[model samples]
Target: AQTVTQSQPEMSVQEAETVTLSCTYDTSESDYYLFWYKQPPSRQMILVIRQEAYKQQNATENRFSVNFQKAAKSFSLKISDSQLGDAAMYFCAYRPGGGGADGLTFGKGTHLIIQP
Candidate 1:
């Protein structure tokens, strides 16, 4: 069974600052995928970042980036220059690397507090 865990239940950062959220996972498969999804107060699930198992390079999207350590089985998300709109519940999820086994397993979530 693959499991994703976000150790930080809540995190706060000042506006325009950067914050890194910790996440770890247990997976036996050599090939798999990880993703970070953000759900704001609106209750919409938005894809923040995604990292492929085979990719040695980390993934970055604007202010969002991921530190993917396949060897340590850890994946962390870094949000740089966070804004007030970035405040939300961030969830880290895992998906098996196979074509048919793409179902996602999600962590509880980390509530991000954006301090003005």
Candidate 2:
């Protein structure tokens, strides 16, 4: 079994600033995939970034990046130059490698607030 945890239920960051959302997971699988998803007011899950457990480098997509510490089982999201559009419910998710049929295991989510 795998589980993801987001300690902060909500987070706020000023416009043009940066914010980091923390996530930790427990899994027995040796190979897996970690992802950060954003769901805005539209209620659609958007894939922000993804990191493979076997990869040593973190994943990044434009202004969004991840700090993946494999040994620590920690994967945190860093949003740079925060904008109002970035405000949403961020979820950390995990899926096993090798095309496992199991769907993504998600965290409780962190609601991000952008302060202008």
Candidate 3:
């Protein structure tokens, strides 16, 4: 079984600043995928970035990047130059690499607040 944990229930950052959301997972599978997803007020789950456990490099999409520590089983999201649009609920998710019928396992989520 795999589980994802978000230590922070809520986080706040000033506009144009940076914020990091922490996530950790426990999994027995050797190959898996880690992801950060964002849900705005619209309730849409948007993929922010993804990292493969076999890959050494972190995944980045524009100002959104991940710090993936495979050995530590830690995957955190870094949002740089945070904007108003970035204010939302962020969720860390995991999926097996083998691709199964089971859906992604998600964290409890962290609500990000952008302070102007």
- Report the error of model 3 at residue 103, Å: 1.3
| lDDT score, candidate 2, position 111 | 99
Candidate 3 contains a number of clashing pairs equal to: 0
**Candidate 3: deviation at residue 116, Å?**
0.4
TM-score of 1: 0.96
Winning candidate number (lDDT): 2
TM-score of each: 0.96, 0.97, 0.96
lDDT of each prediction vs. the true structure?
A: 0.94, 0.96, 0.94
Clashing pairs for predicted structure model 1, backbone only: none
Candidate 3 per-residue lDDT, tens place, 1-116, comes to 89999999999999999999999999998989998999998998999899989999988899999999988999999999999999999999999988665589999999999999
lDDT at position 43, candidate 2: 97
Per-residue accuracy of model 2 over 1-116 as CA lDDT, tens digit each: 89999999999999999999999999998889999999999999999999999999888899999999988999999999999999999999999988648699999999999999
Identify the runs in model 3 with alpha carbons over 4 angstroms from their true place: none
Clashing pairs in 2: none
**Candidate 3 at residue 1, lDDT?**
83
